[model samples]
Target: MSRTVSFTQMKDGTREEYELLRDLEKPFLRLTADRVLEELRRQEHVTLEGYKVTRLEHGLQSATRAERDGADIDWVVAALLHDIGDGLAPQNHDRMSAEVIRPFVRWDVAWVVEHHGIFQMLYYAHHYGWDRNARDRFRDHPCFDSCAAFCERWDQASFDPDYDSLPLSHFEPMVREVFGRPAYAPEVIREGHVSPLGA
Candidate 1:
């Protein structure tokens, strides 16, 4: 049988109850990669900008490009997940996707996911009368160029219908491996760390 906490409210819980909850967390953490992959798979039903590919395919293409370019596992995974939020939070998908991966990948990878929307604006924002140069506001930020390059090279250009993208199964192991790392390693949190592609 499973253990249960007797308290109905957090404030009423005893330390023993809290410890039980903590113990449960370990198994839940191990399932994070599976949940994330399922969420990405759900993007197959979502389409954007009249693109010829589903959002899932777009994600696969982005990851495939990064992998072929010899990016590390972190970069490849980040690329794979960068658009996972389009179905739930289109208006602020970047922030949502970034938060989802923040705990698993390097800080710069999270930053790129967080800010790719803004950097991507440099492409079509002008058509909507928004400032195409809006991303310039962060010109001096350390990760600005990296974020811009991500949008320019991968995120912005991944809408093709003909690009041969890898199967999601090919990336399942990589996802599990990246998410299996410690959420906040001290070395990765330091300043000036770049992704494998140096972008």
Candidate 2:
């Protein structure tokens, strides 16, 4: 399998546009039988996909959804690589996010990737009742409990139902992957804004 996908081919095939959008997201998001499987190397960690979560699948899904949602290139790329840190340790991914994204992307990428788990602190602490040690560790993380404002910013981002149901504003764009061209023409960007909540 190749690290690259023929994103253009997927977007233009003879299918309902929305369906094509979703179809493009399938292989990496569900990598068990992906065309790119051969490209992945075996690792010690177990991930949602055979490849580490950060390698490609989650990155692709986040970037793809981000573009459909109308986020900027930085935001989409942020979404794509946000979990890159998770490749190291799924439990505390932000630290790794900061490390990996900082090198390849930008400070913004490091910021968002670092904070993806910020909102989860409360989720894990209050309802899940993680032990004091675990809770303390989570709370101490730089992104822990800080995403409310970050989330607010992205909460205002636009989404396109024709391409995807997820909001894109919440993340940094990942235009690098599709920089040469787009999977689709970004018709939703042309049509007009759609609410992240409904669309």
Candidate 3:
């Protein structure tokens, strides 16, 4: 049998046991990109009820738009996976999706992903008797404009079934490259840097 931790409770674990677990976790961590791609494939069949395209197609179109707009890998990947949390956290998918990429992407990109839902409200919230200008509350935030542009340019415009979006194969390499980085590296995160929406 493979080696296993001996601790029955967290407090009872020894340093050696924790170290073993950490070492074993390395392989799983390395396959994060694979798991993420699997999630994206799952979206291929998951349409948002009445939308014209599947979630997977929406993501592909968004990513394709970002690429065509001269965006960097970070922005492109962010655009593609920004709505990934919709599968499990519909009401709070923005934040959940942000968390998935927060470790691998720039702080500004993660912030945009986390808050895009509210910014997106600018498009349809008023139809539901909600304030369309709710995003104005974040007007003072450094990433506010970026989030707005991301919504207007990529997210909201990606629902068309007729859009000629690039296939998932086109973005697989980008997703792998981003996820392959050391998680939460300070240089990668660039906490206070606000990269514009496009190159």
Top-scoring candidate (TM-score): 3
CA RMSD, predictions in order: 1.9, 15.7, 1.2
Off by over 4 Å in 3: none
lDDT of 3 at 118: 94
Candidate 3, 1-199: lDDT as tens digits: 2369877899998888888899999999999999999999999998879888999999999999999999999999999999999999999999999999999999999999999999999899989999999999999999998998999999999999999999999999999999999999999999999997786
On lDDT, the candidate that comes out on top is 3
Worst 10-residue lDDT window for candidate 3 reads 1-10
Candidate 1 deviant stretches above 4 angstroms: 196-199
lDDT of 1: 0.86
Positional deviation of 63 in candidate 2, in angstroms? 1.9
Error of 1 at 104 (Å): 1.1
RMSD of model 1 against the true structure:
1.9
Clash totals, every prediction: 0, 14, 0
Q: What is the lDDT of residue 103 in candidate 2?
A: 41
Please give, for residues 81-192, the per-residue lDDT of candidate 1 as tens digits: 9988888899999999999888877888899899999899889998999999989988998888889878877788799889999999999999998888777776655445
- Indicate the residue-level lDDT of 3 in model 3: 67
What digit string (tens of lDDT, one per residue) describes model 2 on residues 57-78? 4444555655665665545555
Q: How much is 80 displaced in model 1, in angstroms?
A: 0.5
- What TM-score fits each model? 0.92, 0.41, 0.98
Which scores higher on TM-score, 1 or 3? Answer: 3
